[model samples]
Target: MFTRILTSALFAGAAAGLIAALLQLVFVQPVLLHAELYEGGELVHFGGDSTVPAEQDLGGLSPVRDGLSIVFTMMIYSGYALILVPLMALAQERGARIGARTGLIWGLCGFIVVHFAPGFTLAPEVPGVAAADVGLRQVWWFATVLAAAVALWLVAFGRGWAAWGPAVVLLAAPHLVGAPEPEVFTGPVPTEIGALFAARAFGVGMAAWVMLGGFAGHFWARETAGRDAAAQPA
Candidate 1:
């Protein structure tokens, strides 16, 4: 069982890392670049030189940032899997069955509870970097949560709650203890642009989380099956 859990976690972590990389390249990077351009305009508005590089670029966060991002992404996924595997194992021990659809719902529900719940809030923006103001972003957060809930409910075949409960608790525990305040980073960018950056960050982070859950759940199921098979053999 330990071996199976470890194997599943490794696979899920790798998948999460890969997805994070893709998201960073395809979605996050482009959004940041656009925000940078917007900030340049704002700088010019203030009669400051528009040539200053964006905080993301100027932070000298090149390859190191990329590596750290991947590491963190993997850690989040693996941690989730670790939290969930025991619950799943218990369910299996009790003869509960979970399908792919069920897992998807669980993933989505977990996403909503963790990301949209009022108990958890965004951290402060770093100095000199335009990022979203912490807390919910008006109606968008509500709307997005609603849409995602419906989508996940459908995809998870309505079993999301059962499969995701333990994982959700695990994820939220730290937040319940209190997350660090958002850092107040000064930026050459306008507040609007900072808000946009914050939104994008949330989107990307959530997307990665859901993808992580899905992959982890799938592999966990596989691991359980293998364990059961081994136990049944002569």
Candidate 2:
């Protein structure tokens, strides 16, 4: 079981990590860049002798920072996978029957609940800065999850196409509604930095959860199959 879980996690984690990276690079980066261009311009024009420092010219140091970031990110995802795989097993034991696809959905749902929803309120910013009010964000997150779960459940249990719609809706909803951008134009850090961070965080966290779910699903499937085979009259 441990071996199965580890193998499944590794495979799922790799795929999930790739997807997460793509999301950040494709969706999140563009949004943050646009926000930065818009808000930063305003700050420069209005602040009249702006006190904000120039963006950090990290130069060669960027590679180092990026490497460390990747290492830490992977570590976080791996840890998350370890925790989630067992939960998935327990869910399966309870007759949840969460296959690979459903596992992915469950993982994504978890991500939305933990990172994205909380982010709506926290509105990522520098440590000292006040985050935006999270109440509305929390509500939206809950609503979205409930809607998605119902849709997925209907599809999974009802054996219908309608469930796919909810899955699609779940995947696209976050991108459509978008995460909150930082309002205040702070120091050297670009305003869009916050948004970028939020997006990356969301993407990475979701990816981690998805990978974990996949692994869990695989383990469950294998274990169930083995049990059934063992019970069959030889």
Predicted model with the maximum TM-score: 1
Consecutive 10-residue window with the lowest summed lDDT within model 2? 123-132
Q: Over 4 Å off in model 1, which ranges?
A: 30-61, 118-120, 123-188
TM-score, structure 1 vs. true: 0.58
Mind giving the per-residue lDDT tens digits that candidate 1 earns over 1-234?
688878876787678767866686566665566565655554332434445444533333367767786777777667766755565555556665654555565555655644654224543232355345535344434444444444433444436666466445544554464444435644665565557656666676677667766776788888767767988959
Taking all chains together, each candidate's TM-score versus the true structure is: 0.58, 0.53
Q: How accurate is candidate 1 locally (lDDT)?
A: 0.58
Rate residue 11 of model 2 by lDDT. 60
> How high is the CA lDDT of each candidate model?
0.58, 0.57
